[model samples]
Target: MSLLDHLSEHHLLVKYTTKNEMEEETRDEGNIRKEDQCNTVKGLKKNWQKWANNHSEYQKHNPFSNNRTVTVQFQKGEEGYGRPREGSRTQQRGHSAHAHLEKEVDELCMIIKSIGEAGGDGQTRVAFGPLFERYVPISNKLVGVLLRARKHGRISFEGEMLWQRRDDDVIITLLE
Candidate 1:
């Protein structure tokens, strides 16, 4: 008997199997008689309406429906396709300073511990230039490190002139 007749007799959905799937079945399992599979579908029901309802529900709530395309225009001599565009000078400086501070956190903590241990007072006094020379060998990232340390409750200003002092001038005490 034909495949459609076999499917209809057992209440199986003919649309569920594509032409490619049917071809693959014929090529791969040709030795197994269709009657054996057809007999096994005795209690199965062909519920096309239920499948259609589920598909409609899935399409309604699909996230890809909200996706939109964005276009960026690049002018002449502007590097856009390959390399990243440079940020504003102030923003770049701030980001680099912040990164430098983060990199120096452990070293700064160790310096504070050592200074506090050496000093007579329980708090450690850290001046920018000496601290910078001690910890950061290459660049002066002491201001950012001290500011971040202050924000994190690791240090605080000792005097009233916090931001007014020169690079080598400001002294901050380590918090216990």
Candidate 2:
């Protein structure tokens, strides 16, 4: 017997039932002509042949020559795949720099608040030169902290023009 006949006889071949047949099965039984059933089977056979041919062509082009399979090497007590235990020096430095910047931002906020309170206007003008000297030694780092503070609504600029300029002498008013 052919492979199709053998599979069909053993009920191993998956039967493709049409939507109408499924709907009719849910309602009442209806008689279907033998020719129509034969046509459906022929269509399913054609679809299967097309799919098989495409798959064969794909395999021919992308043949799996290597028998080796990659296996993950995990440390003792490791559960699943994740980030490596030891990170690069740059990553460590970045984390340290971020932490340092956060500390500087906190100090800067306190200084700005104190300066604003002393002025009795709830606003204080801060120049970059003094800010760099007082809170953060690095000018760029101080700028980052100030930008972050402004973004979080902790501070506001005096004017629109102040944002575009970041000169050492440029003065910015911090508002509570």
- The numbered model that scores best in lDDT is 1
Tens-place lDDT per residue, model 1, 1-176, is 99977876565344436667767765777787878777656524346656778666554544355424333546677775343335535468878977866667767877867754445766767675566566666446666667777788887775433442364666657776
TM per candidate comes to 0.36, 0.33
Query: Could you tally the backbone clashes for each prediction?
Result: 0, 0
lDDT of 2: 0.62
* Model 1: how far residue 15 lies from native, Å: 45
How large is the C-alpha RMSD of every model relative to the true structure?
A: 16.9, 17.8
Could you give candidate 2's per-residue lDDT for residues 1-176 as a string of tens digits?
99978986565224535766656654543466668868997999999999999766544433262424443456666773343224546468878977986776677778765544334575677665565566554344666677877776766654433332356566656655
